[model samples]
Structures are given as structure tokens and as C-alpha cells.
Target chain A: DTAVSQTPKYLVTQMGNDKSIKCEQNLGHDTMYWYKQDSKKFLKIMFSYNNKELIINETVPNRFSPKSPDKAHLNLHINSLELGDSAVYFCASSQGGQGGYTFGSGTRLTVV
Target chain B: EDKVVQSPLSLVVHEGDTVTLNCSYEVTNFRSLLWYKQEKKAPTFLFMLTSSGIEKKSGRLSSILDKKELSSILNITATQTGDSAIYLCAVINDYKLSFGAGTTVTVRA
Candidate 1:
């Protein structure tokens, strides 16, 4: 079974449209994260949630919001997507105090 | 701001060659460093180094961390074409990870 799974493997939308990406983990992990990978392949952490509590929030714009319904689910909602929002978004999960993380296949978002 | 930097953004090597990838970081409340190999979709965890001067190994891949230098190195020995992928380095600080730009390695047979 896939430890971490993300929906909408590919998404293409017009500018200013809003969208949401869902992530689920069955690893029984307490910590989950959302990362963005740009065209240059630079991975940057956008948000982190531990047991449904917001732990880390990077300097991302307010347009992007992360909601963790529970320890097993974390979803990202982007408002008014722009060209810069085109990138690959990956979801990951790990136990607290652990170093290794299990990642999902990633969702590719394209804003045209 | 916490920062992680990786050297040699990209490298090309022939099969059976050995290659080393470097990662350095600057952050407060440092905890550990991790190495991951990304082939196409998701990145697979390779090693995690918490203490300095200790090396972690798996198959032909190995990595070591140096706290004094705030750096780490991942070495691949006798690389095969299958080893070609983007190597990502991440530093953990207070449970949050700051990732480097990553090194792209292409092993040609």
C-alpha cells in the first residue's frame, strides 16, 4: 500500500482560479508536510502540521493555505492561482523526532 | 533565516565511477541532516545523519555528516545508470526541514 497518497496527479487551470490538493498518509505518523518544487527543482517547505496542529508556516503568500483535518490528512488550498503557482507539490509524513519522511507521488499544478 | 546549500548543482559520470555530493547548512537549533534520491516522482529516503563524524551506508550509497563544518557529503560508489537521479539534502531544525537546491546526477553507461 502507498504510505502517502496525493490526489489530482495533474492539474491545469486558468489564472485566478482556486484549487485544492488533498493528501493522506496511512503511516500512522504524527507529522505531515507540504513542499513545493519549482521548475528549477528547488524543493521548499510550505507548511508543516503535527497531529493536526500547525507547526511551521513558511513565508508563503496568504493565497496558499494548508488545512490538516487530522493526523492522517492534510490538504492545500490555493486561491487566485498565478503563473508562479505552477509547480509540483509533494506531501510527506514522518513520526515526531524522526529524520526520514515518506513522500507521495506529488501533484503537478499548472496555471495557464 | 535557515539556509541549506548544495554544491555542484549537476554532475555527469560514467558507470562504475564514484561521485560525491556536498551539502552545507546554517540554522539555529540544528538537529539532523537527511539525504534523499529522487528519480521521477517522489524522493526516497537514503540516509539520516544526526551526530557528526558518523557515516551512514546503504548498498553502494553512503553519507557522512560534519557538525563542525555544518556540512554533509553523500558518496556513491561504483555507480550504475540506475543511480542517476536528483540527490536532495535536507537539514532539520526543531522538527522543520530546510532543503537545499539538490544535485542532479546522471550516470551514463
Candidate 2:
């Protein structure tokens, strides 16, 4: 069974548009995170939520927001998508406090 | 800045050749170090080393951490073509993890 699952495996949209990527986990994990991997394959954390509470917010732009309705779900919404937003976004979950992560298949976003 | 640096960003070798991937970190309040393998998709966890001088092994993969040296190494013996993939090294400090650029390994049969 898939432990961590994300919606919209691929997304193609125009610049200045808004988009959202949904993620859920079945591992009973309390922590969820969103990460972005650029074309160079450098992965960086964007946001982290634990028990529906914001824990870590990197230098990500204000246009990006994360909402966790519950412990099992964490969704990312990007407003005013720009060309630089095009990348593979990965959703991950863990039990928190140094637990190993289970990552989703990733959503490839293309902004034109 | 807090960062994780991996050496030999890319390597190419024939089958049965052993390879060692290195990772060094500079993070405050270091908690643990982890290794992962990424093929054409998402990365899969390999090992999580929290302490120094402890070796973690899985099949042909093995990893060990050196807290004093602030580094870790992943060793693969008898690497096959199927073993070709990007190996990522990440360090967790509190709730944040700094990932290295990753080392791409190409194993030719």
C-alpha cells in the first residue's frame, strides 16, 4: 500500500494562475512536509506541518500557503504561479521528531 | 549557512565495481543523517544514522556516520547496472533537513 499519496501527478498551467496540490498519508504520521526539486535535482524543503500546526517555513515566498485540515492531510496552494514555480513537488510524511520520511511520487508542475 | 555537501557529484563505472558516496554537513543542533536512492522517481530511504561509529547495512548497501568528523559515507559493493541511481545525503537538524545536491551513479554492465 502507498504510505504517502499526492494528487495531480502532473500539472500544466499558465503564469499568473493559481494551483493547488493535495497530499495525504496513511502511516498515522503527525508530520507532513512539502519539498521542491528543481531541474538540477536539488531538493529543498518548503513547508512542514505537525498535527495541523505550522512547524517549519523556509524562505519560501508568501505566494505559497499550506493548509492541513487534519493530521492525515496537508495541501499546498500556490498563488500567482510564476515560471520559476515549475518543478517536481514532493509530499512527504513522518512520525515527527527525527522519524524517517515516506515521500509521494511527486507532482511535476509546468508553468508556461 | 547550514548545508550538506556531497563529493563526486557523478560517477561512472562498470559492473562489480565498488563505489563510495561521501557526505559532509554543517548544521547547528545536528540530529541525524540520512541516505536515500532516487531512480526516475521519488527517493527511497536507505539509512538514518543518529550516532557516531554505528554502521547500518542493507543488502549490498552499507553506511556509517562519524559525528566527530561531521561526515558520513555510503558503500556499495559489487554494484550492478540496476544499482545506478542518484544517491542523496541529507542532514536533519531539528525540524529542518538540508539535502545535498546528490551523487549520480552510472553502473554499466
Candidate 3:
């Protein structure tokens, strides 16, 4: 079984559209995070949720929202997507605020 | 702002060779440093360094952190073609994890 998994591994959509990516972790972690990797392969943290509560929110646009239904699930929803949103979105989970994270297979979003 | 810097953006090496990747960070409330290997899809955890001078090794990959220098290094010995991937370095502070621009390693057969 996958420790962390995200659905729709590849998503291609037109600009101004709305989409959502789902993530689930079977590792029984208490914290979940969403990261974006641009073409430069620079991974940046977007949002973090601990026990279904939002903890850290970077300077990401308000159009991007993260929802943690529970400790084991965190989903990302993007509204009115832009071209700059074309990148790989990764879902990760950890026990708490320490240690290495377990990442899921990224969802490649291509905005046309 | 928290910063994690990875050196030599990319490298090309031959099979049976050794490769070293460097990472340095400046962050508040530093908790630990982590290394991940990204191939085609996800980034798989390789090592997590919390204490300085203690080497963590797994198979052909090893890593060490130097808190005095605020840096860490990942070393791959006897690297094979399968060792090719983007190596990511991240620093954890508080509830945040800041990442460095990954180092791409290409092992030629």
C-alpha cells in the first residue's frame, strides 16, 4: 500500500478553470502539507495542516485553497487557475513538526 | 525568510563513480535537515539529519550534517545508472519545511 497517494497524477486544463487534487496518507501521520515544484525544480511549501487545522500558509494566492478533511487526508483546490500554476503539486505527511516527510506521487498540472 | 541552498545545480557522472551533493540553510527554529531522491514522480525520503557529525547511511547513499556550518551533504558511492535523479534538500523549522533548488544527478552507463 502507498504511504502517501494523490489522485489525477496528470491534469491539463485551460486557464480560468477550477480543479481539485485529492491526497490521502495511510501512514497515520498528524501533519500534512502541499508543495509546488516549478520548472526550475524549486520545491516550495504552499500550505501545511496539522490534525485538520491550518498551521502554515505561505504567500500563495488566495485562489489556491487547502482542505484537510481529517488527519489522514488533505486536498488542494485551485480556482481560476493561471498559466503560472503549471507545475507539479506534491502531497506530503509527517508525524508532527519533526523528521523527514513521506511524499506522494506528484500531480502534474498543466494550464493552457 | 528561510532559505535552503543546494550547490552545483546539476552534475553528470559515470557509473561506478562517486557523487557528492551539498546543501546549506538559514532558518529560524531549525529542527532537522532532510534529503530526498526524486526520479520520475515522487520524492522518496533518503535521510534525515538531526544531530551533527553523525553519518546516516543506506546502501550506497550516505549523508552528514554540520550544524556549525549550517550545511549538510549527501554522498553516493559506487553509483549506478539507477542513481540518476534530482536530489532535494529541505530544512524543517517550526511547522514549516523549506526546500532548496534540487541538484540533478545524471549517472551515465
Candidate 4:
């Protein structure tokens, strides 16, 4: 079974269009995270949710919002997407304390 | 601010050669260090080191952490073409993990 999965492995949209990426994890983990990887392949944390509660929110633009309905799901919603938002977004999950994360395949978003 | 830095942004080596990837960090409230191997898509976890001077090994891959120096090294011996991938190092502080830019490794057969 896939531990962490994200929907729409690839997304191509026009600028100013809104899109959402859904993520789910079956690893029975407590903490989940959303990360953005740019063209340079530098992975930066965007948001973190623990047990469906927001724990960390990086200085990402206000257009990006993360919604965690439950502990097993964390979804990212982007409003008024801009060209700079073109990047690969990854979702990952991990248990509390001393464990590495399991990352989703990732969603490659391209805004034209 | 927490930061993780990796050395030798890219490496190329012949098969059967050994390579060492270095990772160093500076962060407050340090928790653990993790190594990941990313082939194309998602990164796969390789090892997690929380203590100093203890070596973690798996087959041809081994890693050790030095908390005093705030650094860690990942060693891959008898590397094969299949071992080619981007190695990423991450440091956990509180609940967030700060990731390095990653080191790309290419093994030629």
C-alpha cells in the first residue's frame, strides 16, 4: 500500500486560477507536513499539522492555505495562483519523536 | 533560524567506488538528523540519527552523527548505478524539519 499519496500528480493551470492538491496518509502517523520544492530542488516546509491542528506555518504567501480535515488527511488550497507558485509540492507524514517522514510522490504545479 | 548545509552539490563516480556525503546544521533545540535518498519523485528515508558517535548501517549504506560538531556523514560503499540519486539531509527542530539543498550522486557503470 502506498503510505503517503497526493492527488493530481501533475497540474497545469493558468495564472490567477485556483487549484487544490489533496493528500492522504495511511501510515497511522500523528504529524503531517506540506513542502514546496523549487527548480533548484530545495525543499522548504510550508505548513505542518499535528493531529489535525495547525502547528507551524512558514512565511508563505497568504494565497496558500492548508486544510486538515482529520489526522489522516491534509490538503493544500491555492487561491489566485501566480507564476511564482510553479513548483513541486510534496506531502509527508511522520510519527511523533525520532522517526523519519514518508513523503508522497508529489504534485508538480505549473502556472502559465 | 535553523539551517542544514550539504557539501559537494553534485558527485560523479564509477561503480564499486565509495562516496561520503556530508551534512552540517545549525539550529536551536536540536532533535534529530535524517538522511533520505530521492531517485525521481518522493524521497525515501534511509537513516535517522539522534545521538552522537553512534553509527547506523544498512547493507552498503552507513551514517554517523557528531552532535558536538553538529554534522553527520553518509557513506555508501561498493556503489552501483542504481545507487545514483539525490541525497538529502534534514534536521528536526521542534516539529519542523529544515532540509539541505541535497547532493546529487551519479554512479557510472
**What is candidate 3's lDDT per residue for A1-112, written digit by digit as tens?**
9899999999999999999999999999999999999998888999999999999999899999999988999999999999999999999999897975889999999999
Which is the leading candidate under DockQ?
Answer: 3
Give a tens-digit lDDT track for model 3, residues B1-109.
8889998799999999999999999999999999998999888889899999999999999999999999999999999999999999999999877899999999999
The CA lDDT of each predicted structure is 0.93, 0.94, 0.94, 0.95
* Residue B41 shift from truth in candidate 3, angstroms: 0.6
TM-score of each: 0.97, 0.98, 0.97, 0.98
Q: Quote the true-contact fraction of every model.
A: 0.70, 0.82, 0.93, 0.77
Candidate 4: residue pairs that collide:
none
lDDT, candidate 2, A3-110, per-residue tens: 999999999999999999999999999889999999999999999998999999998999999999999999999999999999999999888747588899999999
DockQ ranking, high to low: 3, 2, 4, 1
TM-scores of chain B, in order: 0.97, 0.98, 0.98, 0.98
Docking class of 3: high
* Model 1 stretches astray by more than 4 angstroms: none
Local lDDT at A12 for model 4: 100
Worst 10 residues of 2 chain A by lDDT: A93-102
Range of the 10 consecutive residues with the lowest summed lDDT in candidate 3 chain A: A94-103
Writing each residue's lDDT as its tens digit, candidate 2 over B1-109 gives 7889999899999999999999999999899999999999899999999989999999999999999999999999999999999999999887866799999999998
Candidate 2 residue-wise lDDT at A81: 100
Candidate 3, residue B14: Cα displacement in angstroms equals 1.3
lDDT of each residue in A1-112, candidate 1, tens digit only: 9899999999999999999999999989999999999999999999999989998888899999999999999999999999999999999988993676889999999999
Task: Enumerate the candidates' DockQ scores in order.
Answer: 0.75, 0.82, 0.89, 0.78
Q: In model 2, what is the error at residue B101, expressed in angstroms?
A: 0.5
